[model samples]
Target: MSDTVVIRRSGQAGPTSEVVDISIPSDQVFERLVRDGAVAVARWLGFSEERLADMQLAVSEAVNNAIEHGNKNDAHSRVGVRFIVRNDRLAVQVVDQGTGLAASQLTEGRPSIQNKLDNGEESPRGLGIYLIEQLVDDVELQSDEQGHSFIMWFNLTTQGKEGVDEHHD
Candidate 1:
């Protein structure tokens, strides 16, 4: 179960993937749909209740960010979320049709929300990213002319290797 899940998305380079793509209007109401559905799938795939919560929180943050920040709360714009689950890992991505996150934040390692507040960064930017970073095993960010994507990975094995961090409180 240490193997990585290969997900091949359009314009995304990776191995062949079994992707679950859900696109919704840029309204915040749609966030719950994606978060709940992903948690249900993760549970059906044998993840424990604890794991379900982790996925739920991370997905919630990503979806909220997509709708609020990335899509600028535009109901007409769309937010795309793709879930990929394999034997070894589960990867969730939230893509928005808006300007991406800053590249500098992507390079910083394990940035905490407190750091942002101390540094006087804008509200919730550091907080949301910090929460997602702490919840998942790994997070990947991509920025392009189209929009930004927040791709998060959850490991599914028990070899002490990273699958998911169930607790970040």
Candidate 2:
């Protein structure tokens, strides 16, 4: 149920980066894979414990949405995850095979769950997307003929050795 997935790119001059891809059939595996990627990326970025936990949670929710909603628990379809580390930030992309959402709707924050419930709606989604936006610097959702993808960017400047001096001085 658990595995260490590592992604690597060539021809980079600075700190090395990695991307781990996993195809998970079940919710349990999906959650674990995301957590593993988050841990790996956070460690690679030299993030503090708190930041690592945040990253893990954010990625976990993203993957869950891909599995539960996008793929609809279809075991045949696979979710693609890519993690990239650049000079100043870390980027994670989760792609799922499903009908995409309306881009405009996502851009304009949708009504919250409380609002929907107060209005007498039975169910509501998108709470995770809202949280992802708050947790990371950037979040983008895109879909084409192939599948739907959620791309998230976290600034390394907020964590680890590079930003530690800011607190001290």
Point to the candidate with the largest lDDT: 1
Per-residue lDDT for 1-169 in model 2, tens only? 2233334444444554544455555355656856886797688678887677767878887888887878787766666677777667788888888776735435446547786768877656667766677677788888787778888888877863223332334
Best candidate, TM-score-wise?
2
lDDT per residue, candidate 1, 1-169, as tens digits? 1112222334233323456777778776777778777876676566776767777888998888888878899887788888886557888888888874545555345556686678876663456677777778899888898998889998875322344455658
Candidate 2 colliding pairs: 7-18, 7-19
Model 1, TM vs. native: 0.72
Query: Model 1, residue 33: displacement in angstroms?
Result: 0.8
Residue pairs in candidate 1 whose N, alpha carbon or C atoms collide under 3 angstroms = 155-163
Please report, as a residue range, the 10-residue window in candidate 1 with the lowest summed lDDT.
1-10
Q: Estimate candidate 1's RMSD in Å.
A: 8.2
Runs in model 1 deviating more than 4 A are 1-17, 107-125, 158-169
The count of residue-pair clashes in candidate 2 stands at: 2
